[model samples]
Target chain A: MRTARNIGYILGLPVLLVLVWWLSTLGSVNFFVPKPADLVETFGEVWFGDRFFSDVLPSLGRLVVGVAVAILIGVVGGVLIGSVRWLRALLEPTLEFFRAIPPPVLVPVLMLLMGITDSMKVMVIISGCVWPVLLNTIEGVRAVDPVLSDSAHTYGISGWARVRYLVLPSASPQIMAGVRQSLSLGLILMVISEMFASSSGLGFTIVQFQRSFAIPEMWSGIVVLGLLGVAMSFIFQWAERNILRWYHGQKEVENAA
Target chain B: MSPGTLAAGGAAPPKERQRRKAGKGAAKQLLGILGIIGFLATWELIPRLGLIDERFLPPASEVIAALVVDFGLTAFWVAVGETMKAWFLGLLMAVAAAVLLGFIIGSSDFLRKATNSTIEFLRPIPSVALIPLAVLLFGVKIESSLLLIVYASFWQVLIQVLYGVADVDMVANNTAKTYGLGRMARIRYVVFPTALPYLMTGVRLAAAVALVLAITAELVIGSPGLGREIALAQSGGAISGMYALVLATGLIGVLINMLMRQIEKRILGWHSSIRSEVIV
Candidate 1:
């Protein structure tokens, strides 16, 4: 009985919500909200069919490549500036100013510079996604334990060796946190860039569907985007867990206190 | 906004540059100043140097000139006001709804359980994905922006508020219960204070998110704002004007971040995070 009630608590509202939606849109509201059944059918149709290669794959490719580039640049640059005091101060304000510019605005500027190309879209993603990673990296790297660094220094571990052994591991948690933040930003930007200046991609397809009044198809596009977000988050979390296994272990031990 | 609280949280490593200002070598300080000047010069000279087309890559001086001229135009101020109007209203509504729902849902185990799977499902849906839906419902009006902004920022605050309400001290709550405090009174005297810090952090984050959605919505939906202006200028081949509008939005972003930090400092003064802000 207790287990049944717990199950009810977990599933109750969501089931109720779907029921209400289905009931309300049974006939009349179908024009506005297309039925749940229709949505699922369309979801399968678009995602599993030819639209997969034309729309979905290109968007995913740009997103993955953009985020990967951002992470690489952000981590390396962040470490350089973060470890060196003067470099951070000199560059900090400039970085902040650039980060302050909304990522979408850069789309127009990038279009002017590079035209409506994949490189432009990728650039928009990079500018938008890079900051959080960069800022967090700097914060994470700088926040590394001074005692450990000082020990390394005293032990004659200098320059590259000191950073490789002493710094990166300590800063990994914060760096991962930054990456998590950027993943969502990257998704937002991926759609925006396509919407603003592209011929294809998930965002353009959604707009195209809407413009043609293909309401069901538009809804399907949104569903695909949602699944993409969920997938990215799942992958990120798994990577984060594995990457920071020791950190989590220590955290659990601390929590037990 | 991501950096605002993180920078202020005092968990940051020492900003040795500020600390050693006087005792620091003069050469290092000079290089820093030179770096910024060199960057500005490069911006001014990049197109003038003929590396890029002048028509497309107008010099920094031209952009600055456009910015100065825009200051003299009523349209620029009106655009700024409209953008801020949407941002503040969306942020206010999201906060109100999130706090009310967070409290109601968080305090009840059944409600919390019931909503858990649904929130997880809904939270990660990028707000940009809703642009087409928003336009379909509201057309190219301010309402489109409001819908996207509220939906996106709502999750930020709601999640934080949920965490905050959950963080209510068990001992403090038990003490209230022993004193025969009623449910509302317990929430007021115990839960509210514990949750205020989390709420502020959420608001800081949502402010930035709200601005982002507002701009994106305007840019795509063709609403009246700086974003729309930027799009117009870019398409019309008003390159300097587009850059100026972009710069304007950047200034607004910086201002919003600074304002949020100020508000957080004032409100969270008694909190440990704010307490340590003095040393930084």
Candidate 2:
């Protein structure tokens, strides 16, 4: 009974919002605001066919590659900088300056250098997604327990073994946090890059529909994008749970105490 | 932007350690300056040596020269003003709405529960996805930029505010209640103090998000701003000018970040985080 009430509390507002939207748009002659029924129909026709394969899949593919490459670079670079005192100080200002620049502004710069290619879109994603992960990783590694480091040092653990056994495991929680931020950033960059210049992709299609005054189609495209954001977050959470099981378990023990 | 908080929250070595390292701090600063100089020298060399196409990537000196020239231009300042206007107005609106609504919703268990799923559903919808809708409604104006900026930044602030409200100390709240403090008085005295640090963090994050969205709206929607200027320069084949504008945008971003940090420091001076940092 309590579970049922909790579910009602959770779902009630969303249902009411949708109902309000439906009722307000009922019999409306406004061209921009499509009826909920029409939106549902258009969503099915627009995304459930060739466009899904041609546009959505490619966008997702680019997002995945871009985010993967970003994580690889960010983690490696962050580990290097975090472990070194002088290097971190030397490079810190430059990294902060670059992070300040909005990644969307780089779309034109990348386009100029790399042309209107898939690589440019990937670069756009990497540029934005790298920073949070990189910064967080550095912080995480820096904050590693001194006791653990001393133990490892006394045991003569150094080089790759020390990094693998001691550093990465300790920093995994923060690294995972950075990865979570990167995923959303990657999605945003993917759309922006495609919107700026692309023949095919989710962003391009949505812009195309807008230009053609296909309002319903445009709205449906947005719905798909929103769904994609939700789906990516869900996947990230699942992966994070597996990857950070020890971290979570430790946290739970600490909390219980 | 969230890194700001993480850096602050991370462990700070004790006072004696900091005092001992004081001499090294100057050396570190010098190294940082040298690093920037080295970076600029490399950028200057790359195009000069034809390592990359100079047309696509102008020499660092040329871009810097163009940026200097841009600083003197009335048109450039006008563009900056337009972008700043949108950013300021959008940030103001988002923070006001988020703080007000966050407090009201967070104060009530039923309201918080009811809105939780709805906010979760809506929050991840990237504001850029609303570009089409904004265009349809406002059509190549600052309002279009404002809509995007507000939508993007509102969530950043709202979520932070929600967390802040939830963090109120139950003991402190009850103590205030026993003192015959009314709801408004209790909120003003207890909840406000607890939430201010989180709110500051939220504002800082929102400020960054607002600037990004402002530029994006202008770049994509053709609204009048530095972003539009960059797009104009790009299409006009003024590659050097485009790079200059891009550098200008980067400078603005850096300045805004510094300003936000300053503001956060000033407003949150009495907060434990700030006090601890000072003591260290």
Candidate 3:
């Protein structure tokens, strides 16, 4: 019964949003704010077959590689710092300083230092995505009760064994949270780097299409990107729930389902 | 006091001296500065030695010169001003909207639950990806940039605000209710104050996002902004000029961050995070 009411409530904004979008784009509205119908038409036409897949596929490939590399680096580095208090103290300020510097702004520097290759794009994305995961991992590890550590010690569970059994399990939820944060950041960097300077990828495809006044195609690229973003996030969330089922505080989100 | 008398203070002296120990601290600070300088010096040396292409990767000296000479150009500052205006305005709008909407959405359990999925869906879409759509609709105008900034900043701030609002202690609210406070009064005195810390976090995040979007929008559409200047420099193959603009942008980021930190510290003096945290 409540489900119907919730559905109605959720549908209200999108419905009104579409109506207003349609009305504004009627005759005198801005060309930029195209109607929902027009957008649908454009979506159908440009996002149909090879044109859609070809443009989007490369960007997705880059995002996957870049994000995967970032996770590996971030998680490893985080564990190192988290397990050792001295290392954490030594590195935390430096990491915070770098994190404060905007990642997109590094395009010029990266291009100069590394060239505008796949490496540059991947490196830039890694730079942005690494911080959240690393920081969160530190926090996650820190949050584990020392009593648990002492208990593990008493059992003679030492070194990596202790970390794997006690720290990792307890920190899994927070680490996953960090991963979720990094995923979006990675995508943003991917698109922005491509948009900033590239000859291919969805970002480059959109910019090139726009330069030639291919408005519908440009719009199609954006919609695809948006949908891709939505899809990836959903996938990550589902994966998190599956992997971190022991997480105790997510009842509210599960209740929604 | 004599040296022996000074030593008689015992524990405090040793503890204070240990805290102020310059031995490792001096070396660490020296290493950090040396690392940056070493990096730049190597880059400059590499290009000078013809090991790297100067056209693509100019020497540090050349970049500094370009920055000095070109800093006076009208186009440069005009672009900076335009981007700053959009960024500032968008940040203000985002803060206002996120605060209001976040409060509304977070205050009710039903709305929060229903909207959680929707928020998650919107969260992942990179705002930069919306540039093409924005340009198509707004036509390389200021509105396009502003809209992009708002879009990028909004979700970040909104999420932060939501978390902030959620963090408000229920026990405190129940206490307020027990004292017979009404909904509005309870909200004004209890909810808003508790949420302020979170709101500040959101605003800081939004500021960062706003800067990114503002610059990125200019880059995409050739709009007047620092990013546009950098783009122009890059395409013109003025490598030094590009470096200079990059440095300028970095400096701007540093300045913005420092300014915001001061403001946050002053305004949120009572907050534990600001007061208790140390850099190390």
Predictions in order: lDDT: 0.89, 0.92, 0.79
lDDT of 1: 0.89
**Tens-digit per-residue lDDT, A65-179, candidate 3:** 8888888887778877888866665566556556655667677668767878988988888877887788888888878888998899899998889878888888888788889
N/CA/C clash count, model 1: 0
* Angstrom error at residue A67, model 3: 1.3
Query: lDDT ranking from best to worst?
Result: 2, 1, 3
Instruction: Estimate, for each residue in B1-280, the C-alpha lDDT of model 3 and write its tens digit.
Output: 5445655566656656656766667666665566566666886899899997787778888988888987788877887789889889989988898889999999998788767766876777778777776776787788888888888889988998888888888899999999999999988999888888878777887887788778777776666788887877777877788888877776677677777778888888876677555321
Ranking by DockQ: 2, 1, 3
**Per-model TM against the reference:** 0.93, 0.95, 0.80
In model 3, what is the error at residue B126, expressed in angstroms?
A: 2.0
lDDT of 2 by residue, B30-98 (tens): 989988988999999999999999999999999999999999999999999999999999999999999
Q: Which candidate leads in DockQ?
A: 2
Instruction: State residue B268's C-alpha deviation in candidate 1, in Å.
Output: 0.7
Better of 2 and 3 by DockQ: 2
Q: What is the TM-score of chain A alone in each candidate?
A: 0.93, 0.96, 0.89
The 10-residue segment with the lowest total lDDT in model 3 chain A = A92-101
Per-residue error for B244 in candidate 3, Å, reads 2.7
- Candidates 1 and 3 compared by DockQ, better number: 1
Backbone clashes, each candidate: 0, 0, 1
Report lDDT (Cα) of residue B253, candidate 2: 94
